[model samples]
Target: MTRVFSERSSTRATRRPELEAAVKLAGEIRSSDVAVTLVVHEHKWLGRGTELAMLTEELKTSDVGLEFLTGELKGSHGPSGIVFTVLAAMSGMEREYLRDQEVSLRDIATGAKKGQHSSPATVMRMLREHDEQAATAASA
Candidate 1:
């Protein structure tokens, strides 16, 4: 009963219209009770306007919802130096929460490396601990 969403920007054209369109689409999807996320890539050789137009058209009637993930490889760079960027959007609040927790866990793990000792294993352990805490907090 939850929704998650995300976006990815292409480097081909970082124009305002395209960015706006993407943001608008994201907002619309998120407002509809879908959790939203975004990722942006840089592609300077492509026309932002054209790309935006194409994306706008493509996403006009999407119903399953979107979860945008950036940096996913779609294809190789073409002769024109054009690169294919991938955008993945998922729908669901539970998914969103889990995603957020994973992100936080990663951050904690990374930060812990600076001085404290923490590994992915430790992070997972902490996540479980926090989950229990959360459940306790909710019950109270």
Candidate 2:
């Protein structure tokens, strides 16, 4: 029944629909003398931990009650808020690792390292880039 609304005036792109539905449902309940308890998933903001909590405080006790918590921190997500922080971090790290792998390929193409794996793809890319650099230098 406690009207627990967040400081945030708007919802994130992914959460907007659910939050809007809650508000709409609350409006209907408010028109009546009935009280309802609505359970919603808890969500947190990235780098701002729970900065944009949902409209729990906004619910009127006389009309409805709203609170949500999962068995684990179902709501604790990363910057996207949909992906858990650890997963998000790991995904980025994976991409970086892939890119780092390409560095060795580049080394092989430039004769700085031995091509222990696929030789053609990396060398092709290197040749293209080398030609581009040469053309730019010629124009300069």
Candidate 3:
């Protein structure tokens, strides 16, 4: 049992760096407004956790358009069985936005779209705007 457990634990630990890298990469990609598929392909070995983390962090700041795609990564598929619940908090805002008005998900999606050449501040501002909208709506 001890040997089995250690082996399993070791496997989990080995994937951590990959997951971290993927998360960081996803965050970078989200900020850029570049399609994640393009970004994922450009960088080989972007582990699921890292990508998920990046998306989660990015969504935390703005309205992440591809929630379904992000949801796909939340299950046991990722390395080390890491889940993507970190993004759930964003869903509430997403849901509220969808419920309140005739807003198109496409528009919100487009609103957060960043050009491949956009600056980090631009991405940060977009995320901030999404958060501000959500906060204001919640208060009202």
Candidate 4:
């Protein structure tokens, strides 16, 4: 079993009942450790923004360790940093999407030509288009 430590009296602990209870248990047992097994079921657990951010923080901080209780499970051990990295990238993409939406609204208001869409998938597309434009300009 893996053990995770919780900082008692933390603001987050107060906010989250699970964390608060864990903290209380740790205090009662004279050990600041809690064991947790992470199971992702059909991507539902990761869909929530607040939950995702909290879980990421929990994984990042303390002495939290990941363990698979199921014998049939075949995957990499422990929590991977890739999860957080992907989350961060997704967050960036979301920000970009919002920015693109704002730009589109502004363009509409100003009656400017609507250009290419600024989306996560369009990142590479935009780069390719920019490169092509640069190449054409250079040729000219």
What ordering of candidates by TM-score runs from best to worst?
4, 2, 3, 1
Residue 109 CA error for candidate 3 (Å)? Answer: 33
Q: Which pairs clash in the backbone of model 3?
A: 22-50, 22-51, 23-50, 23-51, 33-114
What TM-score, computed on C-alpha atoms, does each candidate reach?
Answer: 0.22, 0.30, 0.24, 0.36
Candidate 2 lDDT by residue in tens digits, 4-40: 4443532222245445665777668766856555554
Give the lDDT of residue 90 in candidate 2.
34
Tens digits of lDDT, candidate 3, 1-140 = 00111112221122445444444555576577754421121111222222333544454454223222222232222211122242333333443444355555554343332222122223335568989999999999
Across residues 1-140, which tens digit of lDDT does each residue of candidate 1 receive?
33223234333323445555655766677568665443433222122223433443344333222232232322333212212222211112222443465644343322322223222223335667989999999999
Q: Give me the candidate number with maximum TM-score.
A: 4
Off by over 4 Å in 4: 1-31, 48-51, 63-77, 103-140
True-structure RMSD, every candidate: 16.2, 19.1, 16.3, 12.1
User: Distance from true position, residue 103, model 4, in Å?
Assistant: 9.9
lDDT, each prediction: 0.37, 0.40, 0.36, 0.41
Decoy 2 TM-score against native: 0.30
Better of 2 and 3 by lDDT: 2
Instruction: Give the local distance difference test score of model 4.
Output: 0.41
